[model samples]
Target chain A: MARILAVDDSAAMRQMVGITLTGAGHDVQQAADGAEALEIAERQKFDLVITDVNMPKMDGITLVRELRNRASYRYVPLLVLTTEATLERKQQGKAAGATGWLVKPFNPERLLATIAKVLG
Target chain B: MPSSARPFTGASELAGLAPVAQDASQLPPALPGFESFQRFWDRDNGCWMVKILPGEYYVSRSEEAISTVLGSCISACVRDPTRGIGGMNHFMLPQDATQGPNDWLDPAIGLATRYGSYAMENLINDLLKLGAVRERLEIKLFGGGRILAAMTDVGGRNIEFIRNYMTLEGYRVAAEDLGGTQPRKVVYFPASGRARLRKLRPVENRIISHHEQLYLDSLGKQAAGGEVELFD
Candidate 1:
C-alpha cells in the first residue's frame, strides 16, 4: 500500500479523503492546509500527494511549486483536487508540474482510477 | 433520463438547482417522539423547504431543538416558547461598526456584534422582551461553513465562537454536524426543532461566480475585480 498525504482546509473533505484512500488499501496522512502539508512532506516520504487548491496559510499551487523544487520529489506524483474545473487553472497546474487534476465530489471509482494512473 | 420522466417542470433549467437525494434507509432511525415533518417548495428559489413544529404539551420536554443553516455567514435560531415565537437569522459576517449600517438589513453595526455570544445575548433579550423566559430557552445551531476559502477563517472561528458562547451562557447544544468541505442545504423545522442537513456538491465555476457576485452585492462591495483564485 502506498503512503499518501492528503491536504485540505475542510475537516469534512479531509475525513472523506482519508476514508476513501484507506479503504483502497493505501496508508493515509492528513494536513489542514498547504503549510502543514509542506512540514509533513519534509519529515517523511510519501508515494503520492493529493491536495485541494483553495486553502488558507498557503495553497496547492504554492505547495506544488515547492515540492517540485526538491530533488527527491522531482518525479513523485502530485495530484490537485479542486472544485474549480476551468481550463485556465488546469493549464496553470500542468505548467507547475502537477501530474494530474481531479475535480471535487469525484466518484470513488474515478478517484481510484486516477490514483492508479498516477501512482502505478 | 428521459425528458418526460423528470418530475420537476423546467427540469432542464432547474437542473442547476436540483437537490441530491440520498437513501433514507441508510440514515439512523429518528429519535423517539420525533416524527418526520412537512416539506414545502419555494417556487421562486426553486428549492424544497421542510418545517417541523413543536408537539402538543411539549412544555415538560427538556430536549433542545436543532436546525440547519447554509451560507457564507452564520444562522442564529432563537426559541423561547413562553413568548410563543422563535426566529432564525442568516448574517454575512460578525458586525463591524465601521463598515456603515447594512442598508438592506438596516445598517447599524452597533446593532450588530462580532462574537456569537453577543449575538445570542441580543437575540435572547429580544425574545425575552417578547415574553420568552430565560431559564426555559434552548438553542440549535447550524451553518458557518467557509464559502470563501481564501479570504477568511470566519467559518472555523464562528464555530469555535458559538461553542464557547453556549458554554458560558449555560445553554445546551442538543445536536450538531458542522465543519465540512461541501456547502450545505439546511432545513430548520421550528415547530419540532429538528434540523435536516443535505450536503451539496460543489457547483460549476460559473454558478459559484454568480453566487459570489450576489454575496458581494449584498455586502455593498464593488465586484469589479477578476475572480479571486480559490487556490494559489
Candidate 2:
C-alpha cells in the first residue's frame, strides 16, 4: 500500500479523494491548499501527491514547482488532479514537473486506474 | 478586475416546444444538449428546462418550468407578484476562488454576478423589462448544500453573498431553504412565481457533482472563474 497526499481547497473533493484512495488500501493525507500541502511535504514523504489546480494562498501549479525543487521529491509521482483540463494548463503542470494530470470529479475506478498507471 | 461575464449560459429557451425566441442566444455549434435545450422533459409541466452552474436563468409567463441541480451552488428565483414575471439563476463562486464573495462587488458588477449580485441584476433587469417592479419582486434562495464534507465554507459564502447583495439593495427576501448536507433539485414556475426544491440523495449528488466538476474543470480562467457561468 502506498502513502498518498491529497490536496484541494474543496473539503468535499478532498474527502472523496481520501475515501477513494483509502478504500483501495492506500494511506491518505490531506491539505486544504498548496501552502498547507507544502508545509506537510516539508516533513513527511509520500508515494504520491495529488492536488487541484486552483486554490487560495497558493495554487497547484506553483505547488508542483516547489515540490519539484526538493531533491527528495524528484522521483515522487506528483499528479495534478483538478477540474481544469485545458491543454495549456496541462502543459503548465508538466512544465512545473507534474508526473501526470487527472481531471476533477474523479471516481473510485478512474482515480485508481490513473494511480496504478502513475505508480507503475 | 471586476468582470461582467454571465456564468449561466445556453439559449434561454429549451427544446420539446421552444419558448418565444429572443436575440443573442448562446446555443450554437450546438453541444449535444445545446442543439435542442431539452436534456430532460416532464410532460405535466408544459415543458421543463434545467440550468447548470455558475448561473443559467430564464423568465417565463407560460405554464413552463425552469430547474437546476445544486452542489454547494445556489439558485435564486426572482418574481414579480404584481406583473407575474419571474426567473431563476444558478451560480457558484467564480471558478475556484470561493474567497470573500463581497470582495468582488466593487471591481466589476459582471464578475460579481457569477456569484450572486450580477445574477440578481440580470434576472431582475429581465423581470423589469417584462414589467416587474422591485417592490413587487419576490426573492427565494435555495441550494448551498455541504456535498463536499472536506471543502471550506463555500456553501455558506454563497448564501452570505446573496444575502448581503439583497440587503444592500433593500430587497426583502420572501423565503430561503439553504444549508445542509444534500445537494438540491430546484423547480420554479415563472407564471405563478412558485418553486419546489428536492434534496437529492447522496448517490445522485455524487453523480451530478462529478459531471459538474468536469464542466468546471474544462473551463478557462475567465470563463471558468465561474465569472460568467454563461462562460459555460
Candidate 3:
C-alpha cells in the first residue's frame, strides 16, 4: 500500500479522498489546505500528493512549487484535481512541476489508475 | 406534545438518508416567539438535529408529513416576519426551471430574484403568514454544495445571490455554510434557525462531472421547452 497525502479545503472532499484511498489499501493522510499539506509532507514520507487547485491559504500550484523545491519530494508524483479544467490552468500546473492532472468529480477507476500510473 | 415537536420516533430513520449525526439537545435555543420540534441522531464526535418550527414543513426520507425533499441541490432557508411563515426549498439550479411555470412554480420567486432568492422570501412569507413579526425576524442560510463539477459555479452563485439578496432586503444573516468542492448533506431547523452541514467525501470526479453535464443538458432542454433526459 502506498502512502498518499490528499489536500483540499472542503471537509467533504477530504473525507471522500481519504475513504477512497484507504479502501484501496493505501495509507492516506488529509490536509485542509495547501499550506497544511506542505507541513505534513515535511514530517512524513508519501508516495503521492493529490491536491485541489483552489484553496483558502495556499493553492495547489504553489504547493507543487514548494514540494519540488525539497530534495526528498522533488521526484514524488504530484497530481492536481480541479474543476477549472481550462488549458491555461493546466499549463500553469505543468509549469509548476505537476506530474499530471485529474479533473474534479472523477470516477473511482480513474483515481486508482492515476495513482497506479504515478506510483508504479 | 408542543406544536414544535418533530413527528419522527427515532433518529435512525433520518440517519438512513444522510451519513452525519447530531445530538438533539445541544441544538440552538429556540427563538422566544417560535414553537420548536426537534429530533437528534448521535454519531462519533457530533450529533444531527432535525428541528422544525410551527407552520414550517419538513420533508425527506424520514417522514411523509412534509413534501419537501432533500437532495444534493441548493436550499435557502428564509424567514421574513412581514410575510409571517418561514419556509425552505430544495432547488437544483439558480434560474433553470425543469417543471416549467406550472402548479410547481413556487409563487415565492416573484418576490425574490432567483430560485435561491425566492426560497428565502417564501420562507419569510410563510413565517409572516403564520403570525411572525416581520421586523423582528432573522435569516440563517444553508445548502449550495458543489454536487457536480460542471455546475461548480452554481453553488457559489447560489450563495452569492443569497448574500446579495439579504443585503438588498435589509435582513441580517445570522449564520452561513457555503462554497466548497464537496457535496454536503444539510439539515435546516427553521424553528431554531440551526443548520447542520456534513461534507460527503469526493468520490471520483468523473462521476460528478458526468452528473453535472447531465444537469446542464437537462437545463438546456427545459429552456427549450422539451422533455429533458437527465442521463445517457
Candidate 4:
C-alpha cells in the first residue's frame, strides 16, 4: 500500500479521492491547495503526490517546480490531476517535472489503475 | 519503474491531521435537495455564454436565457413581463477589489458608472432598448454568497447596496434569493421572464471560485503587461 498525498481545492473531490484510495489499502492524505500540500510534504514523506493544476496561492505546475528543486524530492513521483486535457497543458506539466497526468472527474477504477501503474 | 519507488519507509501523516480530516468530514451532508450531481455537471451547455464583469450587461430578445455562476458576486435579472424582454448582470462589488475600507464610500468614484450603480442601470437600459416598458420592469436578483469568507464582509455589503439601489430606483422586484454561503447557478430567461437558481455544492463552488479568482488575478497581471487566459 502506497502513502499518497492528494491535493485539490475541491472538498468533494478530495473526499471522493479519500474514499477511493483508502478502499485500495493506500494511506491517503488530502490538501486544499499547493501551498498547504507543500507544508505537509515538508513534514512527512509520501510515496507519490497527486495535485490538481489550477489552485489559489500556488498552482500544481509551480508546486512541481518547487518540489523538484529539493534534493530529497528530486525523483519523487509527482502526478498532475486536472480537467485540462490539451496537449499544450499536458506538455506544460511534463516540462514542469510531473511524472504523469490524470484527468479530472476520474472514477475509482481509473484512479486506482493510474496509481497502480505509477507506483509499480 | 522510476527511481521514486525506492521504498522510503516512514510514519503515517495522520498524526497531525485532526483539523484537516475534520474539514473533509464536514463537506455539506450529501447535497440535500440538488438534482443528480452528474446531471447538473454533465448537462448540455449548448447555450450562449453570458459571463459579465463589473460594468457589463447583456439584454436579449431571444427566447433562450443567459446563465452565469456567481460567488459573493451578485446578478440581477430584470425584464418587462408585457414585452417579454430581460437581461442579467454579474458584478463583484461596489468598487474595485483593491479598494480599501477607508475608500468604501468614495463618492468621487461614481457609483452608477462602477458596478454597484452602473451594473443595474446598464441592464435596465439594455432591456429598454429591446422594447421593455419602463413602468413594467420586474427584477429578480440572485447570489451574494460569502465566497471571500474573509474578515471583510464584502458580500453582505454588495447585497445591501443592490437592495437599496432597487428601492431608490423604484423597480418592482418580483423574486430574490440573496445572501447565503453557497454560490448559485442562475439562468435568466428574457422572453419568458423566468429565473432558475441552483444553490451549488462545495465542488461546484470551487469551480466558480476558480474561474472568478483566475479572472481577478488576470486583471492584476494584465495591468503589469501580463496575460491570463480563462480555460474551461
Candidate 5:
C-alpha cells in the first residue's frame, strides 16, 4: 500500500478520493487546497500526490512547482486532476513537473489502475 | 468490459456542466465548456436566475437566484451567509430496480450516499473557493417529496441521507421543508440567503415526476467508468 496525499477544494471530492484509495488498500491523507496540502507535505513524505488544478490560496500547478523545488519530493509522482481539459492548461501542468493530467469525472477503477501503473 | 455496464459514481457529477439559459447573447458568456445549464434574467424576482436540472448544481458570488422544480429529488440550498456566496443542487438516489425497497442498510446503498456526498461537496467546495467560510454556512433543505408512489420511498431515503450528511459534516441547517406527497418549486437567492418555495399540486404537474423519474432512469443507464492515459 502506498501513502498518498489528495488535495481538492471540495470536501466531497476529497472524501470520494479518500474512500476510493482506502478501499484499494492504500493509505490516503487529504487537504482542501494547495497551501494546506503543502503544509501537510512539509511534515511527512508521501508516495503520490493527486491534486485539482483550480483551488484557493494556491493552485495545483504552483504546488507542483513548489514540490519539485524540494529535495524530498523532487522525484515523487504528482498527478493533476481537474475539470480544465484545455491543451494550454495541460502544457502548464506539464511544465510545472506534473507527471500526469487526469480530467474530472474520473473513474475509480481507472484512477486505481493509473496509480498502479505509476507506482510500478 | 463495456463502459456502459459501469454503475454511476460520484465523479459523474462533473460531466457536461455549463451555463444555463436560452438568451446566450444577453447574459455573460457561458463558463468555458458548460453548455447544458440554463441562465436568464428573472423579471419576476428582479434578478438574474439560473435553472439547473437533475444531476447538476450551480454556485454564484454574483447577485443571482437559482431555481428548480423537484419531485422525489432533493435540493440543498447552501451558502456562507457572511460571504454572500451560495448555490443549489438537484439530485436523486440512483435507483437500481433490482435492489429491494427495504435495503436501506444494505452495503450497496453506499452508492446513493456517495452520489449525495458528491452533490453536497461540490457546491460547498465552490463556495469555499469564493471565500465563503465553512463555519458560517447556513443551509436550507427543500424538496424530497414522495411524489413517486409506485416506486420505493426515494424521497424519504433522500431526506434521511441528506440529514445524516449534514449532521456528520457538522453543518447547521437553518430551515427545511421536506417530505410530503407534493412537488415543489424552489427559488433560492444565494446572495441574500432567502428561499421562496411553492408547493405545486401533484395532479396538474405530472412533468415534475416524469422529469425526475427520467433523470433517475438515465443515471442507472449511463456507464460511470472510463479510461485515461497518465502521461509520464
Candidate 6:
C-alpha cells in the first residue's frame, strides 16, 4: 500500500479522500491547502500527492511545481482533481509537473484504477 | 450579500412543455468546470438540460436548465440574477450507522456535515469566479425528505445543516420546499432564478433511494477492476 497525501480546502473532501485511501489499505495524510501540504511534505515522504485547485493559499498547480523542486519528491506522482476541466487548464497542470488530471465528481473505482497505473 | 427574496415567478412557464428540435449534437457545450455532468436537450421541457446526480453540481452561463432527483438528499439552486450565472448542487451528509444524525457534527466524527459544506462552497465559489456578485445572489433550497425511513432522519439533518450554513454566510434564502415524506424532482434555470419541483410517490422514491444508497456505498473502498491510464 502506498503512503498518500491528500490536500483540499474543503474539510469534507479531505475526509472523503482520507476514508477512501485508508480503506484501500494506503496510509493517508491530510492537509487543508497547498501551503500546509508543502509544509508537511518538507518533513515526510509520501508515494503520491493528490490535490484540488482553487484553494485559498497556494493552489494545486503551484504546489505541484514546488514539490518537483524538492529532491525527495522529484519523481513522485502528483495528481490534480478539480472542477476545472478545460483543455487549457489541463495543459497548464501538465506544464506544472502534474502527472495526471481528474475532474471533480470522480468515480472511486476510476480514481483507484488511475492511481494504480501511476504507481506502477 | 443581502437581497430581498424575489418572488418565485415564471416557474409554471418554465415548466411548460416546449417543442424541442435540437439533437444531442446541437446542444451547447457545458460551461467550463462542468464538463462531467450529463448534458442533453430535454424534449419535454423544450430547453437544453443538464442533469446532476448525488455528489455532483453543474453551473451554467447559457440558456440551459439543470435538473436532479432527490431522496434524503438536498439540492441548492443559487444564481446571480444580474450576471445571469447560476448553478445547482446535489449532496447528502455522510451516514454513520453507529451515530445519530446530530452526532455527525462532532469535529472528529462529523465528516457528514462537512461534506454538505463542501458541496455548497464549490457551487458558490464557481458562481463567484464567473463574475457573479454575492449581494445580487438569489438562493433556493429543495429536497430533504423522510424517504429513508429505516435509518435515522438523515434528510432532516441535511435540511438543518444547509439552513445554518446560509445563515452563517449571511445569504438570504428566497424560497424552499423542504421536509416531506416523498422524493422530489427539481428543474432549475439559473439565469432566470426559477425552479420547478415535483414530489414523487412510491414508484420513483424507491429508485432514487437505491441510487443514493449506491452513491454512498461507492465512497468506501471497492475492488479496483477498471483501467484508467494516467496522462503524463
The most accurate candidate by TM-score is: 5
- Whose DockQ is greatest here? 5
Judging by lDDT, tell me the better candidate of 4 and 6.
6
TM-scores, each model vs. reference: 0.39, 0.48, 0.41, 0.45, 0.76, 0.60
Q: Which stretches in model 6 have alpha-carbon errors above 4 Å? A: A1-120, B1-20, B97-103, B107-109, B220-232
Fnat, one value per model: 0.00, 0.00, 0.00, 0.00, 0.26, 0.15
Backbone clash numbers for all candidates listed: 8, 29, 35, 0, 8, 0
Higher-ranked by TM-score: 4 or 5 = 5
Q: What tens-digit string does per-residue lDDT give for candidate 4 at A28-102?
A: 998878999999999998998988776666788888888888787887888886655567978788888888887
TM-score of chain B of 2: 0.68
Model 4 global lDDT (CA atoms, 0 to 1)? 0.63
| TM-score of candidate 3 versus the correct structure, residues matched by position | 0.41
TM-score, chain B only, every model? 0.51, 0.68, 0.50, 0.64, 0.77, 0.80
The sequence of per-residue lDDT tens digits that candidate 2 reaches over residues A57-92 is 788999999999999898888887765656787888
Q: Is candidate 1 or candidate 6 better by lDDT?
A: 6
Better of 3 and 5 by lDDT: 5
How do the candidates rank by lDDT, highest first?
A: 6, 5, 2, 4, 3, 1
lDDT of 6 at B126: 91
Which regions in candidate 1 have their CA more than 4 angstroms from the true location? B1-232
In model 3, where do residues sit more than 4 Å from their true spots? Answer: B1-232
Q: CAPRI verdict on model 1?
A: incorrect
The CAPRI classification for model 6 reads as incorrect
Model 6 over residues B1-232: C-alpha lDDT tens digits? Answer: 2223532224323675333346778767678667767777665566788888987888999888999999889999999998998999998876653333324454323545545665787798798778887678799999989886675787898898888777755789999999989999999988788898988886787788899998777643211111232564
Q: Which stretches of candidate 2 lie over 4 Å from their true place?
A: A1-120, B1-36, B39-41, B44-54, B95-115, B218-220, B223-232
Candidate 3 per-residue C-alpha lDDT over B1-232 given as tens digits, one digit per residue, 9 for 90 to 100: 5534634434444565344334444454433333344544434213334443211343221221111222234555655433323445554443444433322222222111333332343344345435665557666665555556563466666565666666655677777666667765556544445555666676744554465446545443322221111110
Per-prediction DockQ, in order?
0.01, 0.01, 0.01, 0.01, 0.20, 0.16
Query: What is the total number of backbone clashes in candidate 4?
Result: 0
Residue pairs with backbone overlap in model 1:
B52-B189, B52-B192, B53-B191, B53-B192, B54-B191, B54-B192, B101-B107, B102-B107
